[model samples]
Target: MRSFTTIFIALFCLGFVFGQTQGNDVLAMGRKVKKPKILSIEECKKIAQQEYNLHLGFHQKDTANYNLLKGAAITDWTIYLGIDDLPFAVEFLFAKHGLGVFTVVVCMRAERRYDILDGGSILMTEVLKRHPDAEAKLTISCLPQWFDTLRNKGYEVDERTPYRLYYFENLSSHFFVVFDLKKNGKREEVVIDLYNGFIQNIMPEWKTLEDLKRAQINFKPEPLPEMPKPKEKQEPKGKSSFPPEGKWEFSVTGVPGFLMSDLGKECAAVACTDVMIYWDNNGYLDDSDEQTYANDFCAYWGTNGRATYSQIYSGMPYVAEKHNDCYVPNGGGIRENASWAEAIQYFEALTQELGAQHPMVLNDYWPAPPHANCCIGLYGTGDDKSTWRYYRYDGINQLPQPLTVWRSSDQKWRPTAYVSGYCVGLPTVVWTSPLKGDENIDIGVQVQIHFSKKMNTSSVESQITITPEYARSYQWDPEQTTLMIIIQNPQQDLKFLTQYTIKIPATVEDITGKKLDGDKDGKWEGSPEDDYLFSFTTRGPKVSFTMVPSTHIESKTGCPPPNVQFTKFSRAILENKERRPFKVSFTAQESGEGSYELLVNELNLPEHATLCTLALKLTFTGNYHIDANANFSESIQGRDGIQITAPVDASVITQISCPNSPVPDNDWPDDNYSITNPSYPTPWFIDTESKVGILLNGFCAGMGHLLGRFKIPTVLVNTDLRILGTY
Candidate 1:
């Protein structure tokens, strides 16, 4: 909860030192002196109860919505906003079923924490706690002014709908964070990087488009808070809901334990930062600048308690790796909900194995009230593991001791571990193309590997080898977080329908010399101990005959005729109670009643330039004799062409149509809008990365059609995006 202003008191003393800031505001004496206008509890309560609504000037619908939960049973309270308690919350309240269909959770923290896009983290956490297994993955608004600004900034911006309208004021765009893969435990989603995996952004789904537009009228960003100072370790007072199955007396001196002063403080982030700071001081880091280097890595904890890997490591002055990256066993190998003893055993083994008595962070993943702490060192106050007084960061003391404070207003706390970001750990493979067990990969597809941390490029490159090898070219992103291996020399490409395995030796290390913890066992046995491996089988060389009608076009003389006979089908599916995967089945056919001439043309295999590509090679030879074929290739940027089908778990109205297929409904004045300008040309986008279906309607000839649909790869890859994974 410490302020940047307080942290920069040293800057005030230096007259000549130009303060470098990450904000648009200028510094006082070179450092930005932002004085937060935080109201007092009484002031905030008064405003929330009265003056706030006047400031917002809500219209009829909005005012009604705002007051729906205010006059009665609304749960209302105030807290410091952002990572710093800089601005006090006026009031955050949620009356069940007040806003929209998002009936379960409606919570708010700071102005910067609310999201106009996806529902925020608070909602996701609540949904996880309730549904446990539901995949919870935003907005109605307009922003012409904002779009113009973005356009001038060189973004290929054509539009920014459901955009934030205002900034600052009470209607300002709020702060938010996105978490992926699994950080909360097994019950929680997996925590992978942005390139691949499920993601959850702490967003609010209650506000209407109009309300959000009002808020984004002005723009203001959150400022950084200084690294919190650890206090003297104190035994926390209270009983935990979950009892310790086994007790262990332990003490680790010089453990930097910090107390959270703000309401939104994330315990695990605090504990992990403490460990990293301790590492810097204790020589565990190669480059130490007091706590500055550690602060650089842990700054996200103070802003909103969560950050993407690039958000945390990119552009930092110091190296992205450390002698030790606060390793977790198996990259969160321990189930988040594992018992205390299991977590202890894992960390204890990890610490002892590393041979450096580093502090460990613990989190319970308790959504209602998540708690975390950093354990300094292992010092048993009792004889052994069976008995020990636990001194935690929250100042709780736990043992066989029975202590209650009903007379006091102290809060109950849980000390546990989420395992993932609860501590920084060794690098692990976050995602890959032609995922393990994929039986239909393309022989010529480019393989991609996404790592959790920046890597020792040479260490990983030299040690990686593929079984049933093919001539391949290896390349990496600037950050070295992603690797792409292309099967080179079409003559030496892999065999069709053959399974292959990628082997990365355990000796591979991140930039700081930390070896890969492939098995996540938290050990460094070298060789096979931490080797990483995955296998995928390429698609067969032959085509199938199960295609269905997926295009709308009529042919005459082997060319498309003016009128239409092809039908378009679209449906909106929510919850997808059927548990269906993203798949569409369609077959291509060529038929007509006349002397037919069929022509075959050899098209190049999928290329990265087209993310969605149709692989069939047959075409109609004549003009209006009535030719018909199915091809749907779109997306020229070589990005994820098929992902355009639908967003993960989000409600979608999928419409299947062939490119250049006439837009249905007769909304136009004429069926042929280009009649007067018949030279106007229409084009069908070709998805070449994976595979797609394309139908060409021209005069008919003796022809045979293929039956099959494109198998869109979930990940978009390849620089040229030539061909994606095996289609």
Candidate 2:
């Protein structure tokens, strides 16, 4: 860790000399200084407060305007905070302002080593014992321009430097680092009192060009892979299929390896797009014949020397000729066996390079079938460690980000993955439009692949069953030789999502050979080749339908939020409609002057049935008409119309009506409020000379009740709304 920090400090110093030049009296006469004396926790706090106050300067207000530090639980006794981002605020007590902040993970013990790099202390030692060949290391990489924005705004960074080292002095062994940028081609070192993780003094160091170079070389290394031959080529007959126009759905399986995979141009005939492939490893893949000693490194391991690369070139001809991305597995591939810091570094570089247009796929589905499972990665040793693992594409829509801790233990991985910025990697079937031909003719069959950072279990890889639900009666095509699947998401896409992850499973085999088991055990298990593992989603047919007496109108007093209420309602289900039946229930609110009516149109049915046929059965089908009507109070009246009618004035009794046809209900109110002024100057009613009067206006309020019921023309679908009383 110390070595990496040293490297970062060295690189940071070069920016000022090569590009810009600035002068500052504070940085003049810079010279390397000796280490300062240690201070108590209280002394550290006071220094921090003073510097913060000075930074605030005239902007400082009362105590209410004081700065607050963000805290993290690193251990039992020590709580770390970040206070470097406040430039506008003044720190009355400190020496100067800093551009960065550090998060110190301390323990309850009062004393430990100052600098020793094996791990940390006895606590870390015990934890390191779990990971056999792994060693604790720190990373010292810098955030780019955009990320620098947040870093400058006070975000704390982890080990990403080579200068950093574990030192043991006095009582405690701690990992310490200081960051200070210089303006005159010199380095500034801030004396941070290690006694309590706080800044104490500052000194300028004038270094020879040679010294600067040495510092840079001492800096931390970027988690990157060895650059491969540029301008790689894609395989011919690329895996993905692009349709000419319209809504075309396609799926790809077994894309060439990254080393020889080519991302085809947009104008290419067969375009091979970039996709994501999750790399994972558990001890199960290690056979006794391959390695003499093997423990589950997935559960524990920490090391820097394990960094290596595998050149995974495009294997399939379709991917080799058409696409053009040659992937180096170790460098560009997901690094699970490395230390957490190494994993983080690897992912950061990989994701930044890949950008968008990448797809993620879980090649090896684990934990067995029937039961759902997901995976996670945790970093650090002892109590200072954290878990921020989740499987997700860097920038995917409607995806949940990962959480540091378990939110729930639900059987479904959807909730955890969806909620935690994780991407969904469930296998799906892409639905393309039905081809025009004999109903018996088969268009195409394909499987949709989703990349997950974590697989529920290896069970999915055990056995897979792809079966048609309602189409079971048809003479289905034979399996295995007739169809096959391909996997294609990218390597970089998976690397960033895992922390402390292991190597990916080498071969993904389907235990089931596309056969459906009546007992539902078609899922793969560790069995003989009698069954082939196949993964697929159940699909169904599309249908549409209409409801009769579609309109329902209501008018009542005492309304609530969605104010308009219907005291009387009626609906007519249309007969001879081809659409399926879906149940819909609605209630309206009635209150104050805020009353407003509601109308639902084309509400979609939920996908609840495993079989499309069952979905058909659940919905109302065949020619049939049904009318639903109910009256709640005498104060409510009913009338039929083409649209919802608004009441002109308040009244104790109100009537609402709906149409009798199968059309939807929102079109209902015209009939109830269509009374015209009869006193108009028509040919027969020449009332120009005398004062004329309207007939319906005078008794409009009580006309409905007095007439018993208003008989009006009914349309296929209509509704009327009336107010029971004035708001």
Q: Which lDDT tens digits does candidate 1 get at residues 1-727?
A: 2224222321231221223333544333223455433334454344333322321222123344344323322233322222221232322332334321111111122332211111111122222343444221111111122334433433343431111111122221232211112222422211111110011222243133333323333323221212222211212235331223332223333544443332233444445555555555554455444344435445633453443222322212232244444333211223434455554554454334223444454433222123344544222222222212223343121111111101011121222322222234567787889787888786568899987667899998898999876667789998787899976664324555567999988889887678887877656677787888999987543221111122222321222443433221111111111112223222333443222222222222222122222322222222212222322221121133332322122212212233333444433222121111111132223333434323221100001111211223222222234223324
How many steric clashes between backbone atoms does each model show?
A: 108, 169
List TM-score per model, in order: 0.28, 0.21
Candidate 2 ranges with C-alpha deviation above 4 Å:
1-213, 217-283, 289-727
Instruction: State the lDDT at 157 in candidate 1.
Output: 39
Candidate 1 runs further than 4 Å off = 1-255, 258-273, 277-423, 490-493, 543-727
* RMSD (CA, Å), each prediction: 30.0, 26.3
TM value for model 1: 0.28
lDDT of each: 0.36, 0.22
lDDT of 2 by residue, 463-530 (tens): 33322211111111232111222212211011111111111122232222122221224232323332
